[model samples]
Target: MLYSEKVMEHFTNPRNVGEIPDADGVGEVGNAKCGDIMKMYLKIDNGIVTDCKFKTFGCGAAIATSSAATEMIKGQPIETVMKLTNKAVIDSLDGLPAQKLHCSVLAEQAVKAALSDYYTKNGIDPAPILGEIGECAHCAQ
Candidate 1:
């Protein structure tokens, strides 16, 4: 499938591609059917996302989405980051193939998962905010 110039750029040179040893929050999600996995790291300070990073084991689309997701959330307030969606990530990359769209979903979920972890660590009930962090049903389809 053909990818956008932005997608190719990120696939070749993914940003925030590493782990934060002292991350305030960490989240991991995977699609066993496709063998794609994503791990996200976040550092929050005073309700703002100070930093973000990720490690993705999957296709170019997955890597690109992860890169875009981190860049979008970094330096933003937690409230803003929480509103992030797969559509936003996909749009940021110009777009993704219909089949590869699942990657974008994974990216969104990963970020929310990290935020949930952050809230939980801080003694807050993430369930009330993040809802349910579930696997990508589209990936399984």
Candidate 2:
């Protein structure tokens, strides 16, 4: 499959890779069928995303999406990051193969999952906002 220049760039040199020692929130998601797993870390301070990082074990698409997603939210406000969608991630990467689109979905979900963790840790209800953080159903089918 062909990947965009942006995708290849990210795959070759991912950004914000690794864990934050004192992350305010963390999230992990995987697609059992695809054997792709992603973990995201966030450091929020004063309602802004001071930092973001991720670790992904999957194909090049997964790694690229994770890298782009982290770069998208690093210095944004939490509310702004909450609005991040897979489409945005895909657009940032120029695009992904149709079959690999699920990777972008995972990126979006991972961010929400981390936000959910942050809310929960702060004694806020994540269910009403984040709904359920579950495995990627796209590849399961």
Candidate 3:
């Protein structure tokens, strides 16, 4: 499979590739069984996603997707970041091959997960669009 030069570039030298200690919200997504694990850290303030960062262990596509997703969300409103979709992340990369599309989904999910953490921590209900699942240790349980 021929990966795009851009994908390789981001994968080789990903930006915001680390954790945010004492982060306002942290989203851990995908398990070892899934062959990809991504964790996103966010610093939100007054409804704005002030900073975004991620650590990913997966294929080049996964790394690039995580990198791009973090870059996309930084400085954007938390609500806007929550609205970002896997399709948008994939499109931002020009497009990922069919098999690699799931990586983008993981990235998108991670962002939502992070935002959910933020809302839960602050005792603010997440937007209805987030689908308000039953609370777990991460959410409102």
TM-score of each: 0.96, 0.94, 0.89
Error in Å for residue 18 of model 3: 0.5
Return the candidate ranking by lDDT, descending: 1, 2, 3
**TM-score, model 3 to reference:** 0.89
**1-141 in candidate 3: lDDT tens per residue?**
877877888888898999899899998887766678889999988989899889998889999999999999999997798789889988888888888877888888889888888878989787665874222222221
Residues 18-118 of candidate 2 have per-residue lDDT tens digits of: 99989999988885457688899999999999999999999999999999999999999988998899999999999899999889999999999999999
lDDT by residue for model 1 (107-128), tens: 9999999999999999999998
Error of 3 at 2 (Å): 1.7
RMSD of 1: 1.1
> Which residue ranges in model 3 land beyond 4 Å of their true spot?
127-129, 132-141
lDDT of each candidate versus the true structure: 0.94, 0.92, 0.84
Candidate 1's error at 45, in angstroms? 0.3
Higher-scoring candidate on TM-score, 2 or 3: 2
Off by over 4 Å in 2: 132-134
